[model samples]
Target: MLARNDQNSLRRTPLYGLHVSLGGKMVPFAGYEMPVQYPAGVLKEHLHTRTAAGLFDVSHMGQIALRPKSGRVEDAAKALERLVPQDIMALAPGRQRYAQFTNEDGGILDDLMVANFGDHLFLVVNAACKAEDEAHLRAHLSDDCTIDSLADRALIALQGPKAEFVLAKFCAEAPSMKFMDAGPHKVDGIECFVSRSGYTGEDGFEISVPAGDAERLAKALLENSDVLPIGLGARDSLRLEAGLCLYGHDIDTTTTPVEAALEWSVQKSRRTGGARAGGFPGAEKILSQFDQGASRRRVGLRAEGRAPVREGAPLFADATSGEPIGKVTSGGFGPSLNAPVAMGYVPTAQSALGTQLFAEVRGQRLALQVAAMPFVKNTYKR
Candidate 1:
């Protein structure tokens, strides 16, 4: 059984009661009471999602809609382009793209997903950074655009190899949707906005439904024989195994998208020699890094032993001595791999695919090596 808390100050998602009833271990995260694991535990949950389907309640994420005041899609896209380096204007309707909110110093404010919904742009950002993102958008965007916060909605993610099969049972068109495709759909008569994208490097869908109908929708999905409720614990491990970065941990306000190895998100149209170039914040600094390369970069690490080198662990060039070279940002045991895996920042010279390094953990040194990411291969539906 999961532990219960009497604290009433923390915010609750629409599925809070359902989680409690299902043996969810509630914990405080991003100002909300969310489940970190269920009775099955994180390890089982992680492996289960890999084999079948796992239902995730991600209602803590912030959802926003940007509508152009003039009803011209170009207006809203243009305004957003000023904040991100991605070529928003080129985004086709019903398609989604990954982007970051860059700062003047070339640092990342927050990474988010942008979906062009024909008349408006739908966005999903980190819950912790949502308020700041909204404020920044309002302060920078022109009066020709309007930003609306979708505070009355809930977001659910169904991920795994069987995710498509489970979701297709309710929405017939779901199986035909390709990766990053998003549009309106009805599941059991409840209207929802479904996206064929997720953080877990797996074939999945993220459904946005009204808060009032969230429980009913969740219950229906849970009744599936192949579906099980997953929580934050497994979610973190899954994303880490998939080589995805956590907002504040791997990529933060101090880290630029280029340094985080997210340059692919910045389209060529916003780069030099493209149709529209260099309009986003910190364009000069970011573009320079793209040309000359960054001093440090994010890299994946594989532990030589079974001991998991956790986050905040300092890294060194030598096992016994020498100054620290870098630090582990995200680290833990990868259940699927049955080994210790981590991601961190290191000097560009030491960021090769097989560079040897050592991690300091509890006064002991653990051997580590720079490795390619997605520790597990992605299986997105093309």
Candidate 2:
């Protein structure tokens, strides 16, 4: 849910009217009319999600299916591995993994999710970069593979501690899912693809259902006492607090997975000394950085005071430092932590835990310290 100014040409999600009726403050985000916050405000929404379950409409994201004409699922996986650094061939059926598309120069194109659905590969890319991702996939993949865009589907994220409890009422198998596990299920007679994964660093499920059944499923989920509608504002704050990256902000075309502290997403099977190594784009550069660390790395920051240091705030080595050492990519008040939290890139030497730094905000330098994320503990059911 990347925030943007309202545009007259913005598209609407399947749940747009439902959001409006629930007092959601609609705004443009990723070229769609999305809800940034509701009447409950961001503060309450963020806290409530930590205590209960929050339903998020993430239908703006692009969902794609890659199938091999020869009917070999491994063929589709191998083709996808050519575009991303993850070991797609190693992914077991009904499982998902995080991955990134890299450019020839080792810069990140976009971060995405790849799931194995037994017969085809399921992909979920960021809304803003979906079109470009599709184009890149079609141009590079072999003729034997076919790319299908799932435009008639909608995605919903049910996140937080109580997510499984509420979802299990409709689907008996919801509570038994482990993190990153995905499978087909029926929720209140609506067929859905359910994955026990989310962006909030909590135990949850992401459901992909037919667009026509989106409202019905959402309404049924809301019937649970623990489930409440959450908007983009709290969603942003929650992910930030969880130390997750926002595509355009914390990561982009100019940043590589290594520089963005995402080397873990690149599996060992694709790295040096593995059976299949150096096959993806920019393999030389990305693998080199894995051995010799990146010059600058992304790190979490904790402010000294309650003042929120926002994105673009210049970071300095000390209070009276001369020039900016780095800049804040994502920063804001974390309601769950009851303090200001942020994430940004800094020189590797200054990225260690407890390293002291300063941020320039409103012409005054405020003290900041490199801290360990997440600001709130992750409660995933691993």
lDDT of each: 0.92, 0.91
lDDT of 2 by residue, 1-382 (tens): 2233355778888999889999999988888999999998999888889999999999999998999888999999988888899999999999999999999988889999999999998999999999999999899985858999888899999999999889988989988889999878888888899899999988899999999989989998988888889999999999999999999999988888999999878888899786688788888888999999889999999999999999999999979857899999999999988999999999999999999999999999999999998888899898
Candidate 1, TM-score vs. the true structure?
0.97
- Model 1: how large is the Cα RMSD against the reference? 2.5
Worst 10 residues of 1 by lDDT: 1-10
* lDDT of candidate 1 over 51-156, digit per residue (tens): 9999999998999999999998878999899999998998899999999999999899999999999999999999899999999988988586888999899999
- Worst lDDT run of 10 residues, candidate 2, spans 1-10
| Superposed Cα deviation of residue 147, candidate 2 (Å) | 0.4
